[model samples]
Target: MSAPVQVGPSSSSGGPAPLEDLEDLLADIGDRVRAERQFRGWTQAELAQRAQLGTVALSSLERGRPTLLSTLVLACTALGVDLAHVMSSDWREPERGPSMTPQQAVVLREAAAGGSLTEIGARLDMTAAEVGSTLTRVYQRLEVTHVPRAERRAAAVRMAVQHGLITPQKRTS
Candidate 1:
């Protein structure tokens, strides 16, 4: 026979009760972690071994026990959760803005041409320091760590397409 379940005292009774909000949050986190681990086909013992943590600690964490930030980070790392995805404030790609000024576009193109920052700046009638600062802001707006050559080309192409600087072509046989 199944044992009878005991219900805890409710908050309405003004007696000691479970912290529902905290409990719910912990339960949600636990559910996510458990689901991810299970989806990866990892048993608690295997996960513990791979994470280099004790099975009991792993179990407690999986069960949503309050754990240290370092412990949680270690566990997440072991589970292949890119900490950057959690820590980054903005992950989504931002909407493209208006095309940059002609001078700015020229500066970007020159930079993309593999010229030194100083050379590009000189060609664009700007100082190397100014060019560096401008590039930093541009990169931040673009949401990329470092612009690749192909990405620079793509940006130029996009700008040209947007400003009617380049005409669309029909496909041919």
Candidate 2:
């Protein structure tokens, strides 16, 4: 069985919770995480160790800054908070389609870096045709047909970035 996904209490005034912006959403989830941590009498350091994250990362998350998806998931898992709630925010994609598989996400991220489909296939040990098929599905997920086939790759990347699925690879000198 899965762990219970804890959600916030609804407004006492009988109105839907107002997630006015990204900051509000982050604050809401962070507050819940803090509450859960306090209820168990665990320090942020304790939870950080449990989550296999640094105390600094935990602090950043608690401060409502942009963070890695993995960090967010780890925090939720460690804190026993719903992963959905942590990821919920106004920054969500407005035109999401069927959820992409990890493989599909890999393909999209590879393509996002300006790699040709065949080049991506070479990196993944997949054939060019296979990469093309995978991209077709990604396009469907992002609803980018209006952008033309050749241009959909860039648009899909934008959507993925907007949805926080993948971040640009950081360069190291």
Candidate 3:
């Protein structure tokens, strides 16, 4: 199997983005996919069925692992989000903000992966309330608490992904 990609910032000159840059870009795209999916209250399987993609494929793409561009286009279309907006390379706003703590990142990542608060809390050795509180703090830190209460989780995941706190995890499924 090929080595997993490493996610980082893009190069300024922009000849060909380094492998790390590509990794970051994929993760960014994945974040957008996850955020959109969450915003619509769709699970990976639901989106996958809509897009005619496999659940594993959708999961991999949402986790920021490398995926075919066509698959991404399919998912974007299925989610009803503009492809260009989701694929934008400009990450300036989040990059300028403070970074999230490791715990915060883990919490956001698990949420983006569609983990229930209780499930995530169990995995992290915390109670569901603690998980919810951590997510609330993340929303405050990312300044996204102003978002509608129902959408706050999605917003936090999107912002955390943009801030580079949530890189692609190794393929686990």
Q: At residue 30, what lDDT does model 2 achieve? A: 68
lDDT of 3 by residue, 7-89 (tens): 22224532222343455566677888899999999988899999999999899887777679646655654443444656687
**Total backbone clashes of candidate 2, pairs 3 or more residues apart or in separate chains:** 0
Which stretches in model 3 have alpha-carbon errors above 4 Å?
A: 1-16, 19-95, 168-173
Q: After the best TM-score superposition of candidate 1, give how far the Cα of residue 106 lies from its true spot, in angstroms.
A: 52
Q: Give candidates' CA RMSD values in order.
A: 18.1, 13.7, 20.5
* Cα TM-score per model: 0.30, 0.45, 0.44
- What lDDT would candidate 3 get against the real structure? 0.72
TM-score of 3: 0.44
Candidate 1 lDDT over 10-100, as tens digits, reads 3374332333344444455667777888999999889888889999887876676777734544544443344445467865654566445
Best by lDDT: 3
- Clashing residue pairs in candidate 3 are none
Give a tens-digit lDDT track for model 2, residues 1-173.
12233333233632233323445556555667778888999999999999999999888777766677445544544444455665668334446444678999998888776677788999989999999999898888878868977778888888876665666666668
- Model 2 Cα RMSD, Å? 13.7
Question: Least lDDT summed over 10 consecutive residues: which range in candidate 3?
Answer: 1-10
